[model samples]
Target chain A: MAGLGQTLGRAATWPLTLAARAVDPPLRAWQRRTGTGGMAAVFLAPNLLIFSVFVLVPLVLNFAYSMTGGTGILLGQRPFVGAEQYARLLECQDYTRPITCREDQFWTAVGNTAQFVIFQVSLMVVVSLITALILNRDIRGRSFFRAVFFFPVLLSPVVVGLIWRWILQRQGLLNLIMVKLGLEPEVWLNDRVYAFAATIGVSTWAHMGFYTLILLAGLQAIPRDLYEAAEMDATPPGRVFWRITLPLLGPNLAVVLVLALIRGVQIFDEAYVLTGGGPGTSTLYLTQYIYESGFASLLREPGLAAAASILMGAVLVVLTLIQLWLSRRAEGRKAR
Target chain B: MGRIVLDGITKSFGATQVIHGIDLEIEEGELAVFVGPSGCGKSTLLRLIAGLDRPTSGRIEINGRDVTRASAADRGLAMVFQSYALYPHMTVRQNLSFGLENTRMPKPEIAERIDEAGRMLEIGELMERRPTQLSGGQRQRVAIGRAIVRNPTAFLLDEPLSNLDAELRGTMRAELARLHARLATTMVYVTHDQVEAMTLADKIVVLRGGRIEQVDTPLGLYNRPQNLFVAGFIGAPNMNFFRVRATGGQAELPGGLSLAVPGEGEVTVGIRPQGLHLATGDGPALEVVIRLVEALGAETVVHADAADGTPVVTVLSGQPSLAAGQPIRLAFDADAVHFFGADGMRLEA
Candidate 1:
């Protein structure tokens, strides 16, 4: 057996040894001349080039488009407006009241997006946290229940929106159940407030599974010994939750809050699919407005859409910075 | 005022029964240690007492109150875990006072208790520092301090020193013994380290396969172990065993040495390494070839094999003129020898 294994090992190494004999001298010569920094550059070249082409170029083009006017295909034919689109979006009288502002549709989109973000991210964080805590317990069929909660996240965003659109449409499954339970068969997707609320709920229902999975991972990372120690100390269950579990789950919760906020700010699919910005434009969030301006609606204002997108990107960058700062602070505090 | 009594305690996780039915009593202010090897149910028994785990079939009474179904909080017992499970986010002071605050203890008293425990454990300056800032020994001190701050009926420590380095473990072990000396509480400590058992326990309960092999004082267990497991487990370097068959007032070793042993039929002879001596004061001498020798400053350990290949160990005081592969004849005092029956029960010593 030993001889056979040795023979097999030698046979396996023959091609690799021949390859090494072919390439080893040049590699050694390169290493000797250029060293580790040059090697690292060689390794990093592909990813760096991909990023420059895909991400950096697009970002620079978006910013450049925000400054220019006209729908010309070539960059040379387009005229520079120098923040005129930004100025038009920002021309608000009584900024708190979107109805009183010029370009009130733009202000309405901003207002709706703000409300959607505040409501959606808060509800998403809270509901996901509660779900994570429940699934972390030793309930029967915990894995099955966890998979049930996380199944929606595995679906594509468009599929999620389409599924909810079917469920929440007039004379749909939800209204059918409500009517069977002796509730009024009111319009769900057309009514202004209900349409906005349905968008928030559907979006939350779709994205909650992902956030809950993250928080569950955080919950699992906590040492069971800490809870056992807390039990031995005679700490009340509430105090244990408030003192131990939440504090230890800080970093993951911050990630959830930031991701939810950024995602909420850019919510497009669920609202667009379920309500299509509604009978009165009540559920038209920022990304939908940008989409309509760029492609869908008759007001194909590419420059305005680019400006709105840049502002949305700014909001997302701020949210990300906050997450980084919070997690960094938590890490620093824990380091001692 | 802590006294615990266990009646027919047994614990099983699904089909694997880990703690067998056992009855034991721990008196007030006694420092008892349950000592055993890993998976021997020592920690399980400790958890049962602390109410961290439930016994499958039995009743437990703490301070003469039946707490068989009581929650861990209602049982009023404080436990220090093997990991020194401190709340990482809280300072040492808050870690100590969290339970007290949960009980709605007065502000002054909680502060006073934390201060006293901190000073008692010599961790007064460390009160403001989080547990992450503390070293292993310091964290152990804070864990013990957390238990002390609780001031419960008793303290349950589960391998508290197992996480520390050897030197720190020594320091913490001494500190723990001193803590017991001062508190005089009914403390039930569990550890797999026999040295900790020998040094810190007033009553050492040796367990094997979920059964209590013996329960005695440290010296009592040392001088006379109840069975082979206790004899093998209670000593450092371990007790040496050799097969022997007794005929009337004499026993014959497998290596062909005969000694005056008061037993009949086949039995196992147990002797400590320290019991073996040079052949000067002999009843019977057995020839041994040294296989290995470990020389410490104060004592030297000699590992050797008999003619028929049964292993023998001799621990000599100071340095002996011994080298590996050298043959030497060794003897022991008759009183220092032990005899065990075929069932592993201690027979005539």
Candidate 2:
């Protein structure tokens, strides 16, 4: 029986073997002429082609659109206006009051985004770190808890927004629970402070799982013996965390911080769905401003939206460069 | 002051029991070495004593105080790990002082301890450098230094020298012996290397399958192992065993060879490779054909097959003229011969 099976297997693989033999000669010749670097380029060609078409072309077109004027969707139909759109966005009388600027709504969005970034990014880091530390322990149902925490990250941003809206809306579950608890319920999405705070909370809840996953991997990579050594030293629990656990988790924290910073600046989808830049523009972020200006509003200003997007992209680019540098330094340290 | 006593210690991880019930005592200022093969629970036993792991059912007493339920910090023990386990972010000085600082020791005392450990370990030049910057030997030194500056009641070392190369291991072994002498603290060390156990231990505990096989001085274990397991495990190149039929103080070996040994019925005899020599004028000796010879300048080891096709090995003092397929008679002194009964227990002389 084994002999028959072997014969059948050999028969099935013969054509593939023949094809490989036929290609081997030409591949060897190509390798000999091009060397390893050329082979690397050949392997990278497909990925580079897709990246250029989807990313590079869009970036170039965005920049071109940012420099043009008029309400035309097509670049050729618009007139070159140089930095007029940029100047309009930057023009302000007091620099603090959005009402003094030519693009008051854009200024309000910038102010709101800055506030959200500061509060939401700090909260995300702390929450994610605590969650990662807890999940890294040998607690019962640990994998189940990790999956539950990360379930939100798998959902679409719109879905996440809709889920939270159902809970936080007036006469919703939260209000019903509050009333049952003998507390008066307020309109959560109407109050300016509550609306802004809700947006930050919803966004953090949606994305914190990814950062926690990064941190959990970092925690696991730390050698178990180091913790054992610390225990042997009779070091206190708090000091062990400060002296060993936190320091060892530094590289991971840096990555999480930069990534959370960029994610905070790009906070739009979940927040936009939850608040709709409501309560008199209390939760309008940078991305929502760009969307409203470019495609949503009655007077569509494509040039202004592109300029704002370009500015946001610059911030993201700077953040990505910092992340790259941090990761490189971490790799170098590990190599040493 | 660092006398430790364990009463009925056992450890189980979930359903699997890694360490069976054990009772041991380590005296003050003695270096006790636990030598065994992998998965023998030697390291697990050390961790239990250090309070890094809790026993499943046992009582641990240190200096007459029960510390089985105490946290590792309260146990006042220091440990050196196999991988050195030095905090990679900290400098050598900081590594040595970390424990002292945790104790809220005065800064001047901390500095003094750090300086002393640095000088003692010869790591003063690398004080400002992190562990990653040091060689394996230097990292091991820092790890030991980290343990030393703690000045705890006892020290636990879990295969600390296993990471070093053979040459560095030799040098570090001597250094560790010197360090123990200077400190004069109780230390419980675990290693799979019998040579390390023989050279450095004041008392050696041979363990197998999480059970203690023998506990004795290095020479005691070598000269008289309690059972077949210790007899085989305590020596290099292993002790040679041969089955023989014995009656009335005479054991008849294979190939018409007989020896004066006292055991009834089936008996097993063991001889060290060093015990065997070329039969000068053989009345009754085992005849063997040489299969391989390993010469190491000072001594030579010969591998041969006996007349009954049993493999035999003998170590000679000087290089002897040996070749494959050469027939020779091998003899051992009667006193060097060890006899075991059918149950694998050593027979009392």
Candidate 3:
């Protein structure tokens, strides 16, 4: 009777064991699939979350805000107004009118921002490239000079603006120096033209160091053996710089140009602190215009601000695309 | 044709001296090799001649012009580096034509020269490919072709074949000889390989410890090494040495065996492995116990220990069957023996 009981126990456990083995293949396959899936999701989740909150959601909300009434009410209470805010912004007349349809302040601000971007970005790139070249040379005290040049980049933009404002003030360091040197004191920041130039100069001074460091790093990464070989080939130093170093540094220069352009297009802090977009708004930037329309001014036309923001975003995207296309073309040429 | 005259060339890196006042003349259209161990200043001397580095106190004259301070390009020379140093981004055609382009050579002339060099190097099919696309041997050919298109006064080759494998090195060696013959321009080659030095050099300069030990034709350096260093360095399976003392016009070996002294000194007796013969019955015989026998198809090397356990190598031509641990007697030719003093300088017979 005990032998028969043992036989029955074995017979019953065999099916359970077979069922366990039968479940293993699918379980393993599922585990493998989920493992890869989980790893990929782990890697991508942070970037996706950040992009959704910061970029995608903001872009969608911006478009939504552009199509709504001036007040930033919630979705349920908001009234839809299609394209009217854009029309009003393009045709606004008086500065005090809440939504003037004939004013030119927005366009004037746009023109001023364009001019600032054109001048500041070009000056910044040239200055940074020159500084990078100087710092790249095998001169004594290179590290010290590099630190000195890059120190301005560490300052906050607002602080940099205030420092430059004080320097360019009518009774400030520049006028004081001029008076002490037996020259007439000039109004540097109070005049409209001078204020515009000061804004650009201050912005360039604060930002040139960052680009200089980047360009210097790029220049230093180039192998010294290439230069030695170039010298052996009898190529002049000027030609070597132009043909070899510049072409090889094309990617780095492209990065600098794109960064400077984007920063120039979005300039706001220096204008706000140094000039207050003032001296007749000569140094008013696009971002300042957007800020004034959205929150700073008495009438907060969030819809017009959202439209302007969308336009600026479009311009930035277009500019970035053009840079990307140019980089691709350069890479294609190298591949050939 | 260009001859290099290095006069009192001295170079120092801060406190350490590299080339200590080397004075030599390289004949025009001759392939001269600087053969030395590593850190012996052989490459440094070549760089000095190429004007890549300026000597602290010296003059380098190429084709009778003082170019000690001239740049490498101004010196009218092209170099093939050990690393090959091909521009990774440029095609073979571009690499060969770049220097010419810098000198404002005409487009058609540059093309012609490129084609000529490509044909000469048999790299015509690889002209459009980048250096990264070529094999090691093919890249080496392109490097050589790049130097050839320069039409410079002299060619400075710094261990050009050190990168190739053994079989490819042999082939490239023959190719280099042919290239030199065709060009017939002066060539200064540097290498640590004695075989390369022996086979390729019309004149060889043996350097040690940053000083020239001897400079002579390959056979001259082989047959007439000035010191023990040169003797050991110039030959494969180097000459064997036995410590001995000279007394009463006879050299007393350490084992109490006496042999006639061609010269007198407390000396190191030197005999080439090939110079020793197996004694049959009646000769100046020394009892030896065989340690190892290496049988090559053409010659058999018998490594043995002398009566007093001094290591001796005996090379026997035409197969002589010899076994390990066998007792034998060996004799060395009297004329083939070399005697060096306690100072390691050779004593003239």
CA lDDT of each prediction against the hidden true structure: 0.88, 0.91, 0.86
Error of 3 at A7 (Å): 61
Ranking by DockQ: 2, 1, 3
Please write out the lDDT profile of model 2 over residues B255-300, one tens digit for every residue: 7886777778888899989889999884778788999999989999
C-alpha TM-scores of all predictions: 0.93, 0.94, 0.78
Candidate 3's C-alpha runs over 4 A off are: A1-67, A73-113, A191-193, A310-336, B86-91, B105-108, B236-339
* Backbone clash count for every predicted candidate, in the order shown: 0, 1, 6
Model 1 chain A poorest ten-residue lDDT run: A327-336
Per-model i-RMS: 1.6, 1.1, 2.9
Candidate 1 residue-wise lDDT, A163-257, digit = tens:
88888888788889999999988788888888888888988988898999999998998899899888876777888898899999988898899
DockQ of the candidate models in sequence: 0.66, 0.75, 0.29
Mind giving the per-residue lDDT tens digits that candidate 3 earns over B1-349?
7999999989999999988888999999999999999999999999898878899998999999999999888999998888887776678888888889999999999999999998899999999998878988998999899889989899999999999999999999999999999999999999999999999999999998778889999998888788888888887778888888787768876445577765666788888888888888765576789999999979999999988788988889988978999988887667777778888888877
Per-residue lDDT of A191 in model 1: 87
Which residue pairs of candidate 1 clash? none
> What would the TM-score be for candidate 3 when compared with the true structure?
0.78
Who wins the lDDT comparison? 2
